[model samples]
Target chain A: MHPLVLQYDGDSEEKISKIMTEEIIIAGFGGQGVLSMGKILAYSAIMQDQEVSWMPSYGPEMRGGTANVTVILSSERISSPIINTFDTAIILNQQSLDKFENSVKPGGVLIYDGNGISRHPERRDINIYRIDAASEAAKLGSAKAVNMIVLGGYLKVKPLVELQNVVKGLAESLPQRHHSLIPMNEKAIKRGMEIVNTVHEVG
Target chain B: MKELKLMKGNEAIAEAAIRAGADAYFGYPITPQSEVLEYLMAERPHERTGMIVLQAESEIAAINMVYGGAACGRKVMTSSSSPGISLKQEGLSYIAGSELPCLVVNVVRGGPGLGTIQPAQSDYFQAVKGGGHGDYRLIVLAPASVQEMADFVDLGFELAFRYRNPAMILTDGALGQMMEKVWLKEPKPRMTEYPEWATTGKTPDRERNIITSLELDSGRQEKFNLKLQAKYREMEEKEVRYETIECEDAEYLLVAYGTSARICQKSVQVARENGIKVGLLRPMTLFPFPKKILREMAPKLKGILSVEMSTGQMVEDVMLAVNGLVEVEHYGRMGGIIPAPDEIVSVLEEKFIKQNYYG
Candidate 1:
């Protein structure tokens, strides 16, 4: 059996029918794998038969190497691929944190890697979580796995997509020769979920 | 079951072209739409379906290549962004005059010159009003989602061949770059029979079919022009594709298309939630303009806000269609800045709901 196929409940169709639409914004520097993170999430949504739309900021605005992607996972059909606010925000760098901190809905979730955030999100209505994904990835001896760790933290917070689908998504994204790395990446996801700390909780 | 995949709008168009049994693709790379060419190159459709994908020397060259393939009764296509599309205007005019069946996808960006690479509907006039020099009409299809981007390739071909005219998929940089789920059509086999007008090799059984835009006799040229006009009128009668959302009991209408239409859909949700009765009319075929529907619904509408990512171009067409039955107003945000759904709602309030200033 392939290690990538962790678990298969084959019950996403029944559960996802009741799941509300989740609009997410992932923002960071261009090279931080921000786009890939959103892509993985989008593919995961597809695996569960959810309607998904991934819109990225492009052209001169991204020439600063600043990148952002809006991913909408919905049980119903998505109308606008482009949106102003988000239900959840995953911020990587301080620039992104400052930019998108206010775009989260009042009762939404904000997850950030607290590596260089000078002014953290001060919102009281939304939930804030600080994930030291960079630090955790450094300790894991895989600097490139920072995105996977952050994704893991998000999954922990939401768990919208099941573990089985995520494993399947990893299998789809990674080449066959790199299938051996799936277990390692899965470990990073688990690490993200474990180390993420809640800084603020909305009542 | 249908095959669905998460694909960018540009990638969807490319894949759809291949699956639609396109004979060839000739395009130059440009921002927000370069993916169409890049995707085709990566897919290597030649290997799979004997489809030819080539990066032409220039947009002009690419369009001419499309003209050649289209004239030969092949399902050929070409794509470019705003400035590149401008470069293909001459070729487009020739293709229209020659009455060739081909697909031209323009992923529009902000432009007058080599403007911004961001998404904009500023090219509305260039597309629907005939950007070329001649008095010609190209059947224009505007796709609001990635799914439409895929579906329009097949539909564009069908419509173009039916009229023996040029058809263009007029979209913007946002829809071209954005990714969404798309159910691609099954692979279609390449053409087995050429049209009677096609410039295929002449057999002994028939006269050689000549394909040219040149008509030296002024009387004959005028007749050809009249024929083109008659064909356009038929299209206007048959091909006026649009969608009306929540207009059943609305007092005002929001008219938009493509990316703006998608945003307006959300605006409708927000505005209705706020107890504002507003609906949206999204035109899928811009050239046909859905004028009849607008005319029919005008008497009931308090006002019509034609929202676009331009300095207001489509508003003129809306006004012409309405013909003073009600007020028609133009609301737009230029420079590739996509307006938020709530922002559009505010524009409606300020423009019509607040001041009642509807043109």
Candidate 2:
């Protein structure tokens, strides 16, 4: 099945891929697999024959605190790896939202964990999608899968990559031991997708 | 040929080095330049291109490995920010005196002792006037863009081998950190053979070649120095490169390079917008020093502003280039801080405009 349609329906192929070349930032607290998630997304783009550069931010104490990664994927060779601002940012934690919300381009998407954030971003111009990714991951009996859940939510909104491509990428990239875990990750991803679909419907 | 891709300066340098047919890279992790190492590690070019990337024990070890590889006529390189490059100067001087060919990249950071890992241009004299003791010069190419950073690898290695000397790419934090579109250059054609002078294994037909700077006689050492000076003179004739912006009808010229030149480029636009006849002279090569270019520009120009990220190292070179042909002024913010474009504009306004600045 088409990955973008897994969570989002009624979208033509042409309309779904308008921003596929756009730069995105995936940022959150440490241990959220933010870097890996960005890498997979970036690799997916590269697999589609697009140019990509993935940059992970690490201070002297990256593991002890927040971490972020900037992924620039384009048809052209990417210059300057650092993103002064983002066309879209998928923020999984509150600190990340607060840290980068202002820097997002007007009307840019901000995907956040609904279970963690108590307040909606005060800005009216920006598009905000709240996914209960952590709770969904907990329901799947794997809190560590929250990142995968969030990635699914991101796939729904952007749909720059096809779901089948992501599945193939995960299969090729994951270790053998982790291959068994892909089923659960896919389930968690679907859960996150459903939450966004429901919200996009009501709004 | 027509597409623009955003890339960082450090990544560009690494991509460029790979395309330039560099066989080996040995480097220690350092800020603003870690990406160069990281990109090579992830790409793992060894499988197809036979490039070797090693994370060395220390900067000293890294440079030594470079020395060993370069001794074998292999295209080799090492990169670090500031403090780390300081540790490699001893080896650099030896390589210079031994007349070896290699490339070194110093993505500069603020410094003196464990300075912050931010951008700075304080290594101007270290790179241009020779960092290690004795009279030697490196062919230093200062890149202002990520595209240039990748393109300079081929140019740097070509010049290094041509002159049988070390070449350096002096870039900084902003360029390393910032993203801009870049088109990677086509790889250069590989040389079919090393120079007859390269150190290969000792052959039975010929005596074993010794790569050393040792000279037991004072006269021999003096002769070596004289010969080195002649090589530098030839380089001065052939290798000097600089960029001029808005200078044809400008009154004041701001001299800078690398990331500083990027800022000066912006300053020129701002100064011009504000009705100040200001322009920039950015030296792309710090060691052939571009003295002749400056000497020619100085007579036609008003006062010169030598803006740097150090406490004025390149400013001294700028002054030497002018040689009292015109009054030279300088602005500096050391310890790794980048001087603001507005501050530079203000300096041009006050020093050149209000002070009746004239050559």
TM, every model:
0.95, 0.70
Best by TM-score: 1
lDDT of 1 by residue, B1-359 (tens): 35778799999999999998899999999998999999999999999899999999999999999999999999999999999999999999999999999999999999779889999999889998788988999999998899999999999998999999999999999999998988988889888887988998999999998889999999999999999999999999888888888787788899999999999988887898798888889888999898988899999989999999999999999999999999998889989898999998898888777784555
Question: Model 1 RMSD to the real structure?
Answer: 5.9
Q: Model 1 - which docking category? A: acceptable
**What is candidate 2's lDDT per residue for A47-84, written digit by digit as tens?**
67677766666445466588888877776534335444
Residue B251 error, candidate 1, Å: 1.1
What C-alpha lDDT, on a 0 to 100 scale, does residue B223 get in candidate 1?
98
Q: Kindly give the stretch of ten consecutive residues in candidate 2 chain B with the minimal lDDT sum.
A: B1-10
Candidate 2 chain A: minimum summed lDDT over ten consecutive residues — where? A1-10
Against the true structure, whose lDDT is highest?
A: 1
